[model samples]
Target: MIRRLARFRQRFGIAGRKVAVRTELAWYWRWLGILVILAAAFALAAWMYETGRRFAGFDQRELQQQIRELERQNGRVRDELKGTREELESLRAATAASESRLAIERSAQHKLAQQIKLLERENARLREELATFESLLASEARVSKPLSIHRLTVQPDVLPGEYRYRLLLLTGTGRREQQFQGRLELVVSLTEGGKDAMMVIPEATGDAAPAFRLSFKYFHRVEGSFRVSPKAKVKGVQVRVYEGKAAQARATADATIE
Candidate 1:
C-alpha cells in the first residue's frame, strides 16, 4: 500500500515530467507556410543579386535598350548596303550599254569614212577623164591614129592573184558617125619561179571570149577583172584592140605595176 501510493504520486505530481501543449495545423495551412518560406528566400536572393549588379555599374534594362538600338542600327546598315549593291549593278548595266553604243557608233563612223574615200577617188577619176577629153578636143591634128586608148589602169583587185583593168577607147572624130566593131585582148607579163613569163587573158576557146567582144561608137569604157597564178607576180599589162578577125592589133596600150 505504501509503494502503490508512492507510484501514484510520482505519476501525477508536478515534478514527475513536464508536458508540452501544442495546437495542430491543417495540411493546407502547413503547405501554404512552406511555400511562403521558399518564396521569401527566392526574393531575398534575387534582391541581393540585383544589388550586386548595380554596385558593379551594370543595369539589365539599360543594356537591353542598348541591344535593341544596336539591332535597329544593324538593320538600317544592311538596308543601306543592299541599296548600294543595287545601285552598283544599275551603274554597271548602264556602262555596258554605253560601251555597246560606242562600239556601234565607231563601226558606223568607220563605214562612213570608207564611203567618203571611195567618193573622193571617183571624183578624181572623173576630173582626169575630163582633162583628157579637153586635150583631145584641143589637139585634133595631133590625133592621127584612127583608134586610140587612153587612161589605161591595171591594179590589184581584192583577192590574191586577181587584177582589175580599166581603159577608155576612142575613135577618131572623123569616124564618130560610124559604129566600130572589134575584140579586146590582155597580155599579162609576170615573173614566176625566177623566170619571166607572159600569159593571155581569155585564152582561146575559153568561155570568157564574149566579154572581149566590143561594139561601140566614138568612145567606150572597158572595165574587167582577171586572175592569174597566186605564185606569180605581175610586172606589166598590155591591152590590144583588133578590128574584125584581123590578126594585127590596131591600137595598144601598156600599164606598169609597181
Candidate 2:
C-alpha cells in the first residue's frame, strides 16, 4: 500500500523526500461518506413525513365538512317527521270526535223508533176502546123506550130576507132498532111591517110541498132555509116531528132565532 501511494504521488507531481501513507485518514473518510449518506436519507424521510401529514390534515377537514352537512340534513328530516306526527295526531282527534257524534245520532234514532212504536200501539188501543164503548152504548139504547126532540137551531142566512133552521130527533129502544119514517114542519115567527106574523117554512119558500121528510133508526137531523119579506126580522122557530099524520105521535123542538 505504501508503494501504491509513492507511485500515485509521483504521478501527481507531489513527490516528497519522505511520503507517509495514513490508514486512519482513509478510515475516517470512509466513515464521513457513510454519515453524509445517512443525513440525506434522514432529510428525505422527514420530507415524506411532512407531506403525508399535510395530506392527512386536508382529508380530515373535508371529512369534518361532510359530517356537518350530513348533520344539517338529518336535522331537517327530524323536523319533517315531527310535523307529520303532529298532523297525524290531529286527524286522529277529529276522527274520534266524528265517531262519537255518529254514535249519539244512532242512539237518538233508536229512541225515536221506540217512541213511534209506542204511539202506534197507543192509537190501536184507543181505537179498540172506542169500538167497545160504542157497542155498549148501542146495547143500552136498545133496552130503553124513549123518544125525544134532541136539538133545534135557527139562524139568519146569507141573503137579507133568508133564515135557516136545524132540528134533530132521537128515538129509543121501543123501536127495537127498527127504522121509523117521519115528516117535519117548521113554524117561524117574524116581524112583518112592525107587527108579529107566523109562517111555515115550505109556505114561506113558496114550495108546494107542505113538510120536509126524515127517517132514521136511532136519530135524524133536518136542515132547511126559508126566505121571508125583505123587511121582516125573524124572532123564533118551532120544529115538529110526526111519525105519520100531523095528528099522530110527535116530537117537538123549539129555538129562538138570532
Best by lDDT: 1
> Residue by residue across 148-201, what tens digits does model 2's lDDT show?
664466888899988877655667667746788767777778898879999875
- Alpha-carbon runs more than 4 Å astray in model 2: 1-145, 203-211, 246-249
Off by more than 4 A, model 1: 1-18, 26-32, 43-84, 141-143, 157-160, 194-197, 206-216, 243-248
Q: Count the backbone clashes (under 3 Å) in each candidate.
A: 0, 0
Top-TM-score structure, candidate number: 1
Candidate 1 has an lDDT of 0.90
RMSD of 1: 4.3
TM-score of each: 0.72, 0.41
Error of 2 at 81 (Å): 66
On a 0 to 100 scale, what is the lDDT of residue 220 in model 2?
Answer: 58
